[model samples]
Target: MNKLLCSILLATSVSFAGLISTTDVTVDGVNTITKNYQFTPNPADLGDLSHDRATAWGISGVSLANGETVTGASLKIENLRNWELNEWNSLFIDLLWWAPEGVTTYKDQNMGYGYGKDDDYFVGKESEFGTVNLTRLNYNVFSGSDGMYANPSEGVTISLDGYKREGFNKIFPLYDVTIDFSDSELATLTSYLNDGNFGLGIDADCHFYNDGFNLSLTTQKTSDVPEPCSLSLMLIGLTSLGGAFVIKKRK
Candidate 1:
């Protein structure tokens, strides 16, 4: 009995250690799913008020089952370049979602007359300069609204001064920098995901090119249960201990 109990204890400890080693429980362990999206537009498409300008891409391929909750999220911007020489330029970024009676949507330049672009230009519908419930992630100098959307009480600004141009034709590429979402932002994203509508928009004040972008989301189930591997280890330990007791009784 003493040997059996020792064996079980050792097995349980090893199992838990193995589980902790392989999983980040803080981020919800194996329940996390990260999706990367590419957003390399034509150089002319961005940074130009005329010709090809302002673009929005819908976030797709995210499938979460009922009761699963979004715990964390992030956005990765790659190789953002500024065209101005020795002058700081600002890039506007918006997190877009569908809302009833909402004024924000992606508009193309070829949409014709009366379809003028918004102040932010990237995530706004024709002539509509602000988002519905969503907010701008980056500051918009042109709007002079100080990062607030049409709703002045909402929204937050993320500065990218590190990537801005410091000299003539200077390019500061951000390869590994990831913008982590706050708790409130993650909650908003969860709501958007629940509603089946989400998008990311990008627009630059001066000549700039965004090499690409990647979005990541991590989610976990509401119920807390032991992982499969840990459960298996526990079961095996119990089985072994049971067999040992049976042998002792027979002897």
Candidate 2:
């Protein structure tokens, strides 16, 4: 029985393929028709305080390909800046998959506050960033040195480790937000596979410190076959039944 179960596990493992891709980063629910922006940490430039002003950033692209079923997916971003002066406080971040109302196009030429402008931007203020909450995670938190673990707040938390403007240890480790899709959600995603467009939302409640984070999205193709754990359980149940039948025959 053990050998049979092991063979089942190995077979299921080889039946699936994994794919990783990135789309243009869109902000505030505006689809990236022309361009997308990316943020990276630089200690020298404070003049272009644009990345620091954005309340959210996301990717617009194929979350699942044709004929592929999503077994697992994850969103990864670097929490580059949290400029709060308070030392005791930590930033709590939420990752979401979203949809927008109507069609809106926003452009950013410079990807900064002064250079780019979004005329059709949907989120007006922190109070009104309604689109972000449209829908959304199993998330794990870790530092560059610390091991990953589930956080208590159900969101990633970053501590204020240093002072602002100088010697700021704002470079947080990668924030990995696992995308958990229910059976119905997986069915819904099939409708969008052709267009490959989906809304990714990020929110840091503090409002001011929600900027300067980089984004990446990943999707893994899951096989239709049962998982090893599930198969093992089923096999165990069947073996028990077989054992009972043998005892009855011997009696």
Candidate 3:
């Protein structure tokens, strides 16, 4: 019984679900899952977002390896559901290279997002970061201080679909963009530049284990909640009840 409960906990904690709204391109032959960025600078700060300057990041998507392409395909992101990592040892962001490179190896941050910045060209996670290509980019450090996320209240979300016909990031009829984190959450241009890719294929088959990420679950709500054990029990019951149908169906 203990082992069974543990397995249930493991599965519930590690699983993810996504909805596919569009299917223009087959995400099958996907070789690598990476991120691409877009930058559009906003000169005059309107929202008083408290930054030197701000750029909007656009399209910049989560890449899937070749032989892995499909629009509107429901995706699952197990890592982001309820996960935690061991700081530097078990980081949350994946890396493209393993040779201890700089930050320029990936793509540039799309400064197009509208926001506030108080300096000349804002944002930086790594100093010596380089670029990889015109589309994809990487970053250097993974788990240190807010290198690029210094003033996190500034970076804009990557809008794959314009919310209201080019107004804000929205989901269309055949598309459900399930971003792992908040739109404001920084996936800095410098990070992509330093790492080149978002650790898509760096799994067992690949040369390294830099593919997955390790996260620390902060307080999810805006206020207090139940205790950890209490919350865990509630989640267990909910998860079990929720999956009852699927399990029964499989049987």
For model 1, how does the per-residue alpha-carbon lDDT over 138-213 read when each residue is reduced to its tens digit? 2223443122112212323233434444467554432233566677777777776676745555554444555555
TM-score of each: 0.47, 0.33, 0.16
Worst 10 residues of 2 by lDDT: 5-14
Ranking by lDDT: 1, 2, 3
The candidate scoring highest on TM-score is 1
Residue ranges of candidate 2 with Cα displaced over 4 Å? 1-58, 63-66, 79-81, 87-195, 203-251
Clashes of each: 0, 1, 79
lDDT of 3 by residue, 162-190 (tens): 12221254221111112233322223322
Ranking by TM-score: 1, 2, 3
Off by over 4 Å in 1: 1-52, 99-118, 122-177, 224-251
lDDT of 1: 0.44
Per-model RMSD to reference = 16.9, 19.0, 23.6
lDDT of 3: 0.22
Q: Show where candidate 3 strays beyond 4 Å.
A: 1-20, 24-47, 51-61, 67-119, 123-251
Clashes of 3: 79
lDDT score, candidate 3, position 93: 23
